[model samples]
Target: MSDTAARIADFIEPLRVAPGSKVRLGRDFDPRYRAGLKKREGVELLRTGVALLAEYQERLAAQDTYGVLLCLQALDAGGKDGTIRHVMSGVNPQGVKVSSFKVPSTEELDHDYLWRYARRLPSRGEIAIFNRSHYEEVLVVRVHPENLVRQKLPERARGKDVWERRYREINDWERYLTDNGFKVVKVFLNLSKEEQRVRFLKRIDLPEKNWKFSAADVRERRHWDAYQRAFSEMLSATSTPWAPWYVVPADRKWFARICTAAILAHTLMDIDPRYPEVSEEARNDLLAARQELEEEAPSGAAADPYAARTAEAKDEHGAGHGRPARKKHGRG
Candidate 1:
């Protein structure tokens, strides 16, 4: 890693949730933290990180051994879309799959909350991004406990032990994935209530952004405190070594993008994916194929197969032989 890369990695270290440590979302992390980087510098760093991430993605695709799952959770206007747009713009689209979870359908509701998300997990050699992930079940549903009744759980399953059990299930699930060659990266874009309000205002006031505004988004702001508490509890209980959470400060969109790109770049670098090695026989076969191709006549040369075939046909037909001279056709 270069000095800049090292600095970026160091800067994001504090954002990571330490395993088994209590996390107080509002008290521990500042929404406006910027590591003293100005907007221009942050954007430059973000571009660098994005370039490195693109390279890493290519390697991961070629290696085809492990997968990366990036889960992004946030409140309304928290910049999940923007982060995905900017950070992954340079990566090969074939190697990346993005799934945005919305209100579940009847079929999805019939299964466990995690079932739908599990179906979208990244395949080996691919990067999968969840715009709003399974965390919503704990955060949004917990804040609105009434939503659970619709899940049709038995009385026992709906008891006070539910949240704890879900937390354990989630941890175990992530550990299972990690043990089986998947790297899970969870990021929470921690934006402040005030910033969210400003963004909402922008959505309403700007014509181009008006399409993004929804009345439900404004109503959800009322449960900000509840969501924060739920998030804090979720982070505390489920941030395991196998799948850690990074609480990114998202007040400044540029800084958030840079931090997210840097973290992703670091994770991919740690995975250290590489192109698969070729056996000696495969290498020799490739060398022979290259030699055969090189020996072929270049396009437009006299030895070109198409050119030789055309000449042979002309001679066979005696088109160039002395005979009654054919009159040139004229435009009618």
Candidate 2:
């Protein structure tokens, strides 16, 4: 396979492994898969991708009929934050939303496991990214079965068939979303346990990243083997043709981000959203309004103070500095 194709294949190959499977993709799949691109023409493609996805954001936002759902699943310290930040940098925040799932709250526990997730689903003409999502209930919760009891699934629904049944439900749920105009692109950030240990240690060693470490993280690492088994089983069961998984290698953060952006760009283009054309009457009305605004708009500086402040802010910060400042290093 070509390098990019091989990268993609390596990511998805692990999903085919059954639950409790002790397989490692980094070794099973060639680590040198992307080495050939190091001094080659990948830069031009990456630049082209930036402009292409920007245009896609415009077209996608204009369609107003469908939305893009980005599902990012990863172990702790696997670069989920970095992937989202770099890969989605080109997209307009007005048309994009992100939700980070945390431990269930009292209110969240009262509803079905998927209830909290459904509330965060994307609206038409927007993109929604889940840093970690409903898949956690299957992966993490499976390893810690007590979580299943906490979610309050009836004892009957929590039968021996629970895991398989959850898979079918998730597949049906995704198909229903697709049929109703949602395009789902799921990415699993696959980092080796050894790599993760290095990252976790970095978090503790780096002053800025120290807040990201917690006692719970250390505790979770203790259950690493169980989590892997759960993840393998979850992927094998839930990966469908409609909502397939892309297992991104997290050993290299930049490469993983590039792969994610490529996946998003391909999915958006496949949907073929386009900007709506103005009708003749609407065009004339716009022209007339433009003329009137030009006549009435105060000459040089008085167009609007709010507009002036916005312009000054844009010039001060780089373009697309809409949100408040964020810490440069952290984990969520």
Candidate 3:
């Protein structure tokens, strides 16, 4: 890694939630932290990280041994879409899959809460992005306990400790995935109340961004405090050694994108995926194929099909309709 990349990786170290460490969203992480980088510098760093990430992804795909799952959880107007777009812009689309989780469908509601998310996990050699992930079970469902009534849980299972139990289940699930060659990187876009308000207003005022605004977003904004508490608890409970949570400062979009891309690039470097090696026999076969190709008749000669057709046309049509004909020649 270059010095700049190394510095960026070091910068993101403090953003990761230490295993078993308790975190208060507002106090533990500052949403406006910019690592002293200006917008132009941050964007340049982000592009650099993304270029490195693209190389790492190609190796991961060729190796086909490990997969990466990036889970993004945030409040409304928290910049999840923007983060995914910018951070992953340089990666090969064939190796990445993005899934946005919204309200559960009727079929999804019938199953356990984690079922839908489990089905979306990354396959080997792929990167899967979760826009709003399984953490919603703890965030949204915790904030609005009434939403759990439709889950068809046993009455006794809806006790005050339900969120705690769910947290444990999620941790265990993530650990299991890690053990099975899937690494999870969970990120929370920590947007401040004032910043979110400004972004929401932008959505309303900008003609092209009007579609992003919704009355539901305003209703959810009212429970920001509750959501923050839930996020704090979730981060504390599930930030394990295997699947660490990154609390990215999202007030400045450029800074946040740089942080996220740097973290992901560092993770991929740590995984150290490599292209699969070819065996001696396969190498010999490739050499043989190359010799055969080199021994073939030179291109544009009579042995070449397209060349033969052109020669026949020249012989029949006298080379050109409007120009003088030239003497026939062998391949140059």
Candidate 4:
């Protein structure tokens, strides 16, 4: 492996919550962990990661055998948007899609919670990023059970065990996706309460950022402990082998993005996608077409625009040393 790749793997290992490992967010992880990287160094690592991600994405698309689903979960101002913007900046837009989930619409509310997220699952050979994923059922809904009554779920499905049941359901769903060729990678941007407070203050202090500040966001702070417990439990229950959770420290935005890109690059590396190889028949067909195209070039190189382009192409092919390009002139 390249030194950079080896370093990235080492960097990400500490962030993964192994399957069946109990999770205590505050006790086990530091929100401000940057692994001793300065912002400039982290940016350089992120640049390497983004370039690797783009190269792998092209291979993944051409291979068309696997897809990737990246889930980002975070509290208010935890840098989810910035992570997506920077980590995904170099990928082809057509091969990558971002789906942001917020308050459900009336139509969305009418179906099972997973229904909305299921509709956005990545097709084979594409990447789909979920800004906030189906885990919201366990995080937000676990914290505020009042939203349950709004759902008006069937009597048997609405009980104290609902959270545990939903966890099982989500794990099963992810496992199914993995077995079928979609890799699910989940990241929780772990931000400290103090850092969150500072971000809120900054939002209010800057005129350009004022629109991002909402009074309700402050009100939500009152339930911070509840959300913490909810997040901890959700991570514990869902960090399975099929879909592991990486608790990225969001105190440093650049480091979090670096970690996310590293994780994505690793996932693509595991998939090892490659362009389809041509068959001997296809190779001969290609050679036949090349001959036809070469023959189309008129003897005089400057007459027709089409012929001029053909002559230029033939000249490029003709100028190289070594074995001659074949001509099937006498063949049918």
Residue-by-residue lDDT tens digits, candidate 1, 70-104: 99999999999999999998999999999999888
lDDT by residue (1-332, candidate 2, tens digit) is: 45644454454354333333344444443322343455235455556566667888889889798898999998898888987877767778898899999999999999988899999999999999999988987888888888888887777998988888888888889999999999888888888788888888999899999999997888999998888777666766776777877666667676666667777877777777888999999999998886676568766755556667898787658645675543558776
Which pairs clash inside model 1?
A: none
List clash counts for every candidate, in order. 0, 0, 0, 0
Model 3 bad stretches (over 4 Å): 1-6, 297-332
lDDT of 4 by residue, 56-122 (tens): 9999999999999999999999999999999999999999999999888899889998999999999
Off by over 4 Å in 1: 1-8, 297-332
Task: Single out the weakest 10-residue window by summed lDDT for candidate 4.
Answer: 319-328
Best by lDDT: 4
Compared with the true structure, all predictions reach lDDT values of 0.90, 0.77, 0.90, 0.92
Per-prediction TM-score to the true structure, in the order listed? 0.88, 0.78, 0.88, 0.88
Decoy 1 TM-score against native:
0.88
Task: Give the local distance difference test score of model 1.
Answer: 0.90
Model 3, 190-297: lDDT tens digits are 999999999999999999999999999999999989998889989999999899999999999998898888888878888889988899999999889866765696
lDDT pick, better of 2 and 4: 4
Candidate RMSDs in Å, in order, are 11.6, 11.6, 9.2, 6.6
